[model samples]
Target: MTDPDPQPWLRLDPRMLLVHPAREVVRFLPVLVGILVAGGASGAGPWGLLGVGIPVALGLVRYLTTSYRITGGRVELRRGLVQRHLLSAAIDRVRTVDLTATLAHRVLGLATVVIGTGSVAADADEQLELDGLPREQAAALRVQLLQSGAAAADDAALPSGTPPVPVVRFAPRWLWYAPFTSGGLVAAGALIGVLSQTTELFAVRIDVTEDDLSALTGLAVLGGAVALVALVVLLAVAGYWVVNAGFSLTHDGGAWHVRRGLLTTRETSLDETRVAGVTRGEPAALRLAHGARLSAIVTGLARSGESGAVLVPPAPRDTVADAASVVLGTPAPMTAPLRAHGPEATRRRYVRALAGSAPVVLVLVGAVVAGASPALLVVAALAIGAALALAWDRARSLGHTLVEQFVVARSGSLRRRRDALATGHVIGWTFRDTWFQRRVGLVTVDATTAGGQGRITVPDVRVGDAIELADAATPGLVAPFLRLGSDA
Candidate 1:
């Protein structure tokens, strides 16, 4: 009862590939008539059915040819018709077991599961895919993989788990934030572009006088712009609803459980003890709205570079704080006041930024005014001002501090990130100085580690402060590498 069931050899459901062919049926009349007119197929009525049957036939072949098994502490996959190919990954090294099911897969009650080593160090040519698993089976497999991986590879599994407690729950009011985040804007832009392109493909002929046609063209353009904006907003709002609706986070057993999505439900679980660090991203817009998003940086999980593994979807600062307390294990330092790198860094940023931007602005305003649009000058001035503000913000954000077992680094200008890395995970120190930084007696120190952002960079650090800070963050890790001229 204690051990998991041995993974049985599995094949994809033949119904999985029917997703696209189902579309052919939806447009059966048009597709069939077109095929008949073009003589694309040998026969008329039954022959057109072949268009829809091809994918299903291929799926049957794949279902018969491809096979996978998860047993004996490793996952094995094999698939190929002409040439046999086999790939295996140790269950202990598995960082992520991601399950995705589109509407089509859901209709057939199947999901595609990707088991990754959790490191992006490998190229895309390497894929760990086991497509079309039953939903319940996939979930069971994910749990088995995580539990095993956590206990052995990173000693991530906790002896016990806290009782199920809601860390973050959906708030209908936060729906307003949907338009600002990734899905909303992206969906809106895509909808606009698609509609515009579709309109372009249609042929329309009109006869009118030159002046009348001009007026009509202006009206059409204005109406089209308005329509596009409206469509974009609608799509964005709808997409936001579908992706983030019913979002919730809970602590169950030794892990954190996250669930979200509208049509295609997704649930992810991460063992708390195995988490390497925590990353908080504050986009300028989110910062303005007093909101932030948080992600877990864990030892074994493929991460979108820089963001780590996002745990908390964009939410209010208070919500983030609550989630952080549970994930990072303490009073959340996300909102804590951070130390600055000094006025010297600020001065350097301002001087360098404006120095680069001022010439372009001046040239556009003076010499280029007649040849180029005045709007260019205006844009340059605005960009220069924004860059100056961001530079100052970046300087203010520069700092590294040690709070007990945590080594925190604050950096970034526009999309500001605050990384709270566990001190025990700190592996080594990297110290580098640019020519300008050296002249100013400042250097950049990066804390290189095994997982989570790989390294945390603290720029404009005085050499003396950098060494002392490193010594504090991880006591003996950096001491041997440093030179104490007088002590030696």
Candidate 2:
């Protein structure tokens, strides 16, 4: 039987033709400020106009020229003023569609869509959106693309689907931890900023008296240091939470949709069948709280500048399995047998941890030798010991199981985790060892899958055993079973 026509298509409103006017204004504000600054400094009207007016004119032209239409069978976009351009893609050729909103857009109730064709090039076909369109309009456009059979017809649609997939909604509770957990990287960024400031400030050698140095050692200096550290930590945590807000995933009909981000909101969709694997991860601390993150390894989704894995957010354990079942069209069984590493494996892990801490140890030693305070030595030692303990715990929790059609790996100490990879998803395999590991007759196993690369160091595992596992999981042997048919 023939399928019904897909629901929800978008036709540009005449008003939408002037896309995101506020964005244009915001973008041009800096140029305007630069122009005023330059005009004051150089006392030249033409130069100031060249700097400010050009950007404002370009922004106005960009806003006025761009337009798009989402129809049952295709998406059409036209842009450019003098050098007019038009681009059209059949619903089938479009592999993925994403929606994004920055803080400004959110305030104005607007969002943008990024369309991907699975190409290696950096730019994706994009649409700059304006306000007045309902959220349902974007969701409908995604559904129509999936249901129209565009995903199934194109080889680019790695995980093809039928009908269109349902939208995943973020649970309210998830929003609470999203900011803090996801913002960890932001905190790291803030810390880096603080250090940069400190470095730059300290580098300037002002010839000053001993009283100047003493003045620098006053309460203001100490308070500033403490405040800077606290601010960095807070910013990091806030960034994490903001980035993860409104996280959701759903598969209805044949497509998969993921919506996330707070200040810069994003929505991404793909063919359900193209997904290759499902991974669940938990950091040591999150394990105690029974929290875990979900991610899918799909063929076309690119992370960084290259093809890599895309991690879904800090999902509950139950949600991960549900998302996997929907996206992959197979039940994700909990098959990874939990087993503690052998004593030798644990010892090797501890040694590896110590080796990793060597740089910190050496830095601390140098500081001590340079007449640094004893507290610095104590802090370094404590940090190193804590890191080692965490690594050992993770090693102790490591386990793997080979299933008939999939391989499951479970690892984590405080936050237990599992990853399920269909055998066909295995793209390549490698066995690695450092000189120290080889001397000890141990090796680490690395698996390259269609979605991205993942590694599990079977610390102190017999080299022969590691080699066997690598061979068994090799692409040549595993691809046949795991590889989905083109029509999938």
Candidate 3:
């Protein structure tokens, strides 16, 4: 079917004029104050005002100069004082439109509309965000954009029939045990800070006579042992709670919107076609709890801010699969049971964990030298135990699947996890083996997705199998000669 014709543009509500010139002014006040205070203290005199005043004035001017108009067919933004700027994009190019209101804006009945378009203008793909718009006006503008021809392309691509919106999902409230469990660590850190400061100021010293040492050692043994166990229990619970907050995946209109976060709520939406990958994560303890988290990598959305990916914490495994199907445009394949790798692979992961604990080991060693007795050996043993537990967890969490156009990896203990990436989204691929891995015929496969840092590395796969998996996931990455070799 042919696409609908574009409509003519219309002016936005005059209330759009409320976008305060002072809002930007207020934003920079803290920095301006810091500069002013430092300069005046340093005897920069009125010269300090010159540094502060110019930038604030320039910012105010820029803010005042900015204006936006949402037409039936296009959105236009005009800004700049001395130099004029007019940015316009067809309503058809608009990819996604978002509405946001801070507490102040909510009180003022104003909202901001951030419109994302494929075309870039003035160094950004966000067409024109109309801030300080009346709530109705913002809603009307959103409706206009959604009804426009551009939205038709999005609607046509979505799966037919609306999916149910989750009214109640895993929220932070379900995990209050997290704070108490983790609160002591924060308290302990604060106590350490206080003690360190006291020591620096007063040069306090503990002199242990033989009898005093015996008593103090007994007390230390009791306190340290209790604190260590409490800290571990708290940390595990806190991690679980954090992994469970703000879990929601909703199908709104023609796109999937995932809202998650604990302290700061994050909402991300993407067209079905743009989803490049989906990942699930679970901790060992979470596995027993029958909870898993889901994450997705999608295209078209901004990589920065809260728009990059969808994070669902502590979702049931079935829920994760449902969300993945909605977001990734295909049913999530069943994950294979995790199997232990070769002995060398297991040893490598364990040794790596041990290497990471060097600093903690050194601290314990230092405590022994400081006449704290060799009791720190308990701490070292606990640390080693935690490391081994994590290694065992990883071994239990290892599994992968090759789907039609995606490669899926599932890992995590207590909390189980999975990641699915489309072959086409594989921007870069690499196979790496250290000298030791080479001798053992083991390798790692890494793939780069569109958003975020750090490559996704599946470490310790068999060398030949790793190459074959990489080729299956990203046929373009394999050489033509390799294609013949594979067929042969």
Candidate 4:
């Protein structure tokens, strides 16, 4: 018999017309600025202002051409004005469904639904997105897409009236840890950079004479520095609180649901089976403050903000660990004692760290001796001391452990991260040996998988240990490739 007819294609919500044009205009605002500038310089009329309509036309074309449908066990999308491309993926391959509503979309009662397959390629066609759907419809669609993959599994069917069990809820106290996370500092820096670039455009001027600077007392300067730091921390805390206002993780319908954000709400769902593992991180500043963050190693998700992989923002270390254990269904592997890399790795760490910091320290010392401020001498000493501390921490953190069916690896000083990846999810193994590594009898083994960063690296381990770890992590996968003689 011939196959049944496919479902009718559905168009995006009409409200998207308004949202898309605004987005397109912002995206090309720089070009629009240039056109206006050129027109003004040439003594032209307001005709150049019509350039804004180009984005509107483009948005209209996008809305007119884009269509999607779920039919014949597949989700298909057809879009593009010139290329007219079509993309489709099997329904069972849907790994995650994300619903996002920016300020504009929320204002228009619209949400964007993103469907991720298990493909990790950067190609745009690997995933399908519906840019404008009613908020309720998008939520329903997300559930439908996620549930379709598990329709045959008995456990996928939740009992009637079963409420979503909350795994983690936003805590007001968590805001105290935000300043140490440095997310705000990064945002502040970006904002400052953008403002600086647009200063001339805005016709802004600043005049601070040397005499004005000299008039400031030492105490006033110190107070200003303290105030600036406080301001940064305060801004960071406020931003964190606002963005993560109602953050919550819940389990229902055989999937993990993450909901967060205030002005721009986001809800993401991933099939429980697609969870490969969890990563526990302690950035230097956050670690010092005894705070930690957690992210899920999802099969089809990128390890970025846009991926909705973050399960816990910077919070108390114990609190993060508790949430991680709940997600993993076992004690978190980060608590396991790792087998350290040998003395050679320690030497490498120290050599690399001092090599980078020595020149800076020397320059500072020279400046101090050449009649610069005595604080330069202190700063040089602090630099050297910081380098040594960092080197020591990096060496200490360089290790790996096998906990149950999960392979755990820890690395980095400034951004210390411990990834505990399930061995069953490992699809391949790669052993890397540079000339120096070979000389030191050390190798970096990458546990390749379709999850998280796509690979978990156990660095600076003995070649024999690396081989053994790989073989043990995924039995028989690496043993057949080994040679009996020196090549082994």
On TM-score, the leading prediction is 4
RMSD of 2: 7.9
Worst 10 residues of 4 by lDDT: 151-160
How do the predictions measure up, each by TM-score? 0.82, 0.67, 0.65, 0.85
In candidate 2, what are the lDDT values of residues 1-488, reduced to their tens digit? 13266434344333333444554656877876877787889897887667655655666666666667655566667777887767666666656666666666555555556665555565333433323344556556555666565345444444344534443456656544443353555666767788788878889554789887788866889898887666655675466557666666755455567767777877777666556677676766455445667677665555441212344576565665566665555654353354344556676767777878888888998999999987899978886988788787867777665554666666656655676676676666655677776666666655666543343233345555555555465535534533341112
lDDT of 1 by residue, 1-488 (tens): 22387767777665655653454456565765677666655445666567556545655666677888877778888887776778788877776556777677787888778776765546543577777788878867777776776544444343334445468888887776655566656887676587677777784344578887667776798998888766666776687688778788876535566777777766666666567778888777778878888887776554463332557888888888878877877864565566677777777778877887877777777755578776786788797887788777777777777774777778776778888878877778888888888778777888877666678788788777888888888778778867652131
Best by lDDT: 4
**Model 2 vs. true fold: TM:** 0.67
Candidate 3 global CA lDDT score: 0.61
**lDDT agreement of model 1 with the native:** 0.71
Using lDDT as the yardstick, the better of models 1 and 3 is 1
**Candidate 2, run of 10 with poorest lDDT:** 479-488
lDDT (10s digit) by residue, model 3, range 95-172: 556666665566567776777663324365334666556777775666566446334655544333555666337754
lDDT of each: 0.71, 0.60, 0.61, 0.84
Clashes of each: 4, 24, 19, 0
State how far residue 27 of model 3 sits from its true place (Å). Answer: 4.8
Against the hidden true structure, what lDDT does model 4 obtain? Answer: 0.84
Candidate 4 C-alpha lDDT tens digits along 318-361: 88888888888888486878989989989888988998998998
